[model samples]
Target: MRQHQNRSLKERLSNSAFCHFEQRGELPCIVVQHPGFTASLLPQGAQLLSFCPSGDTSWIWLSPTAEYQQGTSLRGGIPVCWPWFGNADKNSPEVQAAMAEGQPLPAHGFARTNRWTLTRLYEAADRVEIDMSLPQSHHIQSVWQGDAELTARWILTPTSMEMQLITTNTGQSTLAFSQALHTYLPTTDINATRIGGLSGHPYIDTMTGWQRKQQQGDVVFQGETDRIYLQQASPLRLVTPQRTLLIHSRGSRSTVVWNPWITKAQRLSQFEDNAWQTMLCIETANAADDWVNLAAGANHCLSLRLTVE
Candidate 1:
């Protein structure tokens, strides 16, 4: 029996607002709608496709250029990058390592490109809960050679959304990996928006020769901005003309902020180059120097929440 079997479906969906499976575009999806919030999930990659709160625009950004084809990573929304985060662009990146030894790597790992099983969904008066998992299997073990299982859970309320990723080592050997909830957030104008609560924190500017610098104030964008801010747990605020977004998290040691700006934006599928001003990415992560090492039979959980004010 699977370890997740211990939790029955009835108990899991007892408080769910409403859960159903339906076709979304070209893919089959699980859709959840409650009083003030609505969300959709694709079992492929267990990807979160959309999230919206009543009276507010969609906070999660799904690229118009994103491909829905199976086994491909969508350019937007929250692509759960596991066993690694981002591309192995740098020499000796953490995603290419395991148990102190180098291992094969795929950009953002294989989690987001594979299918996930829906384990449970719950409907409640005020919130909806969802659970999806990818268990250890021959194909999964073949890719990373780690006997592990991954589970993703989400709780959505009228005004907020939360997601958690739990990984357990089911093999006899210890396993190590880095990960992120690469959340693509929407905005009215990327250039005019400012991110507060990270002033004075240090970050690595990935595009500027990977230079390390301390923030002067709330982060603002003028051009291409791709940075990894280390060890900042304070809530993040996105100030835009139309609305304000509050992003909070637990079990996160790093926050990555990115916007392809003009140059890189044109290279993405399903994304219009000029549309760069419409979205920004503030990811929750344990990447680079902060990878996790799990002992056999052990588990770790990473979580995040989003609210609008």
Candidate 2:
């Protein structure tokens, strides 16, 4: 007979709040908490970071850091930046020229640095809802002609996690941009883990001069892996010997999977020496080569769901 032990109330609460939660369909969810943010996860351990009154718990770090750097101020939670992805070099003359024309900011655009307002919070029978919005900033206006709005919603249950991002162009002309949900995941060993789901797809390796290649098998961790997967019709999967994480998306034209190990992690003060072995970045996005074109007075939406078994 298989022995079954029920979890203690404290354990359940801790898991539900900090680690896991039980919902319908025998699904379990994880919870991530910090001072200001409280988010739930699916049994598969996929977390949705919800911005709340107290603080945010989402991880934030530079390229070389393995662990997320803790923010000193309330304004510094894991920010979701848009319009541009990756570095905005301060020393680059080309970047400076763009700034001179009003497109100024550091790498990965201004969305992550800007503050977002929590618009709604409620609970349904089996799920919790969270909503946040980012409006056009002066910096954004200087670079782009019209106003823009980004609205994000998180709906969660113990068995599932869903995120929706809606971008609206309030300006006069069309808005061309790239966007992504930069998710940082914790693991036991990144090098030992193999990401499934794109077994036979093609990807562009940004680290290797943007070379395109067909994936023969599951994605394995080796050194520094930076790839933007184009035309990916398969779901993204992260499988360890002990756990498996599945990421599903709709309306996203691209996916980005990255890891900076060893020497890269050594350069960042925020990361511990072995931290890179425990984290991964698998983002569902429309970025880089695949930019979005939003017409004036129009809106575009992207959605992602995470599940673990």
Candidate 3:
């Protein structure tokens, strides 16, 4: 790590022993190597595409069919779902209100597709930090009300990885929206994975009439599963046959657990139907009744941390 800090940016890029930074064709990316972990980041949307601890393979399950093209949401990795959580047509009252009048709004807002500026990227003795910001411009003020900026930062330490999203409402009036770090995690098998810590919350099951139900035990995926657990922000554990993944978060109001089984999995672009068995999402979010009411000049932040046993 001392070597990383001593090297200049050019030297660091050229020296693979410290770090790797390159503009791959048009997609710029950076990979940091600390004694405890290795992590990668993409400038597009300020996304964290990969992370692996000293003795592990990749814990993030990136899609084999992911497209690295600009302006397109890559199939996997942690997607920054801000200003909204789903389709604008679906209409969470606050999300619909922020959209440009009469224009077809994109899925999960504009933060993910926009190219974010790297605010800071540095290596220290114990870890590496990469911070980025998506500062919205006035040219799109006609599209969305309020002046706001979104930032995502990654902290790669020896034992765990932390990612945070900070939103600042720079304009007057209040801003209302739901957001999430839509994170896709690796799984040995969907059937063998059990999610703990969501056992007692009231959740809306997306597969069956959007009905609300209480979770009785650790969540297990049998068929298709999409549920929004309201108001529960406890640390969660993903128990699989091979290992257990622990997730802890702060400033997050809701948790969404989703797995597209047979039918829905078949319809998704850049995703293989049978591939669903290898990955599942336990998203730390502010969705449903948990929408944020950010006042003028105020700020809000949501963060997630991951560890494994």
> Per-residue alpha-carbon lDDT of model 1 for 1-309, expressed as tens digits?
322432343344445547655655555567776667788877777789888887766778887767777678777878898877777545234345442245555777789887777787667788888889986655565666666789999988888889999998888976778889999888888878999988888888888888988998899999988999987665889898778888888777889999999988888778897889988899988875667878899999988888876
Give residue 68's error in model 3 in angstroms: 0.6
Kindly report which residue stretches of model 3 are placed more than 4 angstroms away from their true locations once superposed. 1-17, 23-26, 138-142
Which candidate tops lDDT?
3
Task: Give the candidates in order of lDDT, highest first.
Answer: 3, 1, 2
Give one digit per residue, the lDDT tens place, for model 2 in 57-139: 22222223212212111111123546656654412232233232534455566655444444555555556666667666565
At residue 128, what lDDT does model 2 achieve?
A: 69
Query: Tens digits of per-residue lDDT for model 3 on 1-309?
Result: 323322443453674454687554456677777787877777777788889988887778788888778778887889898788877665477666877887667788777877776667667778887788886755345556656878898888777889999999887888888889999998877888999888788998878978999999989988889999987756899998778888999888789998998899899988987889999988999888788899999999899999886
Q: Give the RMSD in angstroms, all C-alphas superposed, for model 1.
A: 4.3
lDDT of prediction 2: 0.59
Kindly report which residue stretches of model 2 are placed more than 4 angstroms away from their true locations once superposed.
1-79, 88-103, 143-146
Candidate 3 accuracy as TM-score = 0.91
**TM-score for each of the candidates:** 0.88, 0.72, 0.91
